[model samples]
Target chain A: MRAVDARVRALESILVEKGYVDPAALDEIIETYQHRVGPRNGAHVVARAWTDPAYAERLAADATAAVAELGYGGRGGEHLAAVFNSAREHHLVVCTLCSCYPWPVLGLPPVWYKSPAYRSRAVLEPRAVLAEFGTVLDDDVAVRVHDSTSELRYLVVPQRPAGTDDWPADALAAIVSRDSMIGTRLVSV
Target chain B: MFDEPWQASAFALAVALQDRGVLDRRDFAVALGGELESGHDYWDAWLAALEQLLAEHGLTNPGSLDERTAAWRRAAAATPHGSPVTLDADPQRLRHP
Candidate 1:
């Protein structure tokens, strides 16, 4: 059998020739995912929400639009919804069918996300899954699992840690993690 | 671990196709359904499924995809060690770019 790389490259070339895909655009996207975009973009959005109530409101109202407003343009930013992890509710995201993710914000989906166990268990037992990630929430806080499918991806806005009201947005962003935005890990300090 | 360059490229290609609305969720699902249950070579399965989808959409056929891949392999084998491998003068296309 031919190497998968060769096959993929061939398919890409064919697609490019047919005009279904543009080689330049595809290369740009590959370059972006390779070295440009990742979890940091998501952290910036989280930090902005934490620092500015107005921005947070905008994010809450329409996450995709809010993210674009922040000037993040790339793949997988088209459909997004910010699920705020407040005192009353906590959000966890998983792509049950496949590893759909917010590429513009959170970058690529982690390996475990594409696995069968994590995908099934995340929705079935979110609390247990969170505990496995070293995040054990109180019983009062509700667990809302978001099935982050291809069309509509989700971003978990973890609640602002206490006593950081005076911190700058950049400083706050430093503590916002990729898993925290995915709701697998909680942000502290 | 989609850490390799080709791995990222393959994954990105699918996402890019879907983003352009050329490939939908149902198309992705039908193509990738079988591999979703397996434990091996997820990316290979993904590429195969993409090829199938492209064929179904009349973009390109499986035979052409295979032939082009073989051509690339031959080109790489024939090229020098220090330079790039390009499908320059194949009989299928009159001019090489």
Candidate 2:
């Protein structure tokens, strides 16, 4: 372990000694959040919104409560704000302050989301950012950028694909890519 | 991240502190933002922010972070190679809540 690593280890040992945290419970927490928290939690929310107008209304009104109803709660999901996409406008999520992401809903943020390049450019040129992700929107549509903070994080709900009218909510969720929820990619087929 | 053992340890330490209300989430974000503005490496800043709050909250004692860190350096050097390093207060731990 390097110096910083050693320091961190010392810190953890100290914290454990102080009884502030239990080693077993910390292991469980790490197990719960490592890599991706399935990333499907947000997909379920999106699919439910698409198939049920009433649920969608509740989501738009109280993003946090709606997410908790689905049994997910933590940092980013605690004070969430969902932004729904539409024919006239688009929404993209970024955190200029830091890599504050909706971890409970979308799992750990992708590496690019934490990169300074994406942080600066996403707000400066969202359309270009989206295009770089291979999502080309119509010229007349407006692109909206949502910056995340510790107090509130935003999730983009991409419009349901055109041919998915007959698809079940589970099927719709299966097609909801992580990037779509992050607003970097649009769902298709 | 798995490639670096400390990365996960650093992350876990921060989470545990925050979970116990020893570190404030909003305050932590502000510290991170400041570190980023100063051009520190992302992970360095994350570690620094946690260290900052840890020190402020007296988890390692306010002015003793440097001392404790240096102590670890000594401990690691004294421990035989291929064996896990143990602090002077090893296993017994140093405090009671």
Local accuracy of candidate 2 as per-residue lDDT tens digits, A1-189: 467867777777767888887887677666777844857999999999999998899899999998888888876577999999999989999999888998888987777888888999999989899899999999998999999999899989999999889999999999999899999999898
Please state how well chain A of candidate 1 matches the true chain A, as a TM-score: 0.93
How well is each residue in A1-189 modelled by candidate 1, as lDDT tens digits?
237667777877777777777777677777777678889999999999998899999999999999998888556777899999989999999988767789889877778877788978998889989999999999999899998766789999998999899999999999999999999988999
Per-residue lDDT tens digits of candidate 2, residues B1-97? Answer: 3347677777777777677787888999898888877888777888888877766766667445655666677677777788888776333235421
- Candidate 1, residues B7-66, lDDT tens digits: the string is 767776776788688998657855675567665455666776777787878888778787
Q: What is the interface RMSD of candidate 2, in Å?
A: 1.9
lDDT score for residue A2 of model 1 = 39
- Stretches > 4 Å off in candidate 1: B19-21, B38-40, B89-97
- Candidate maximizing TM-score: 2
Q: Which ranges of candidate 2 are over 4 A from the true structure?
A: B1-3, B61-63, B70-84, B88-97
Each model's TM-score, in the order given?
0.88, 0.89
Local distance difference test, per candidate?
A: 0.81, 0.82
Candidate 2 Cα lDDT to native: 0.82
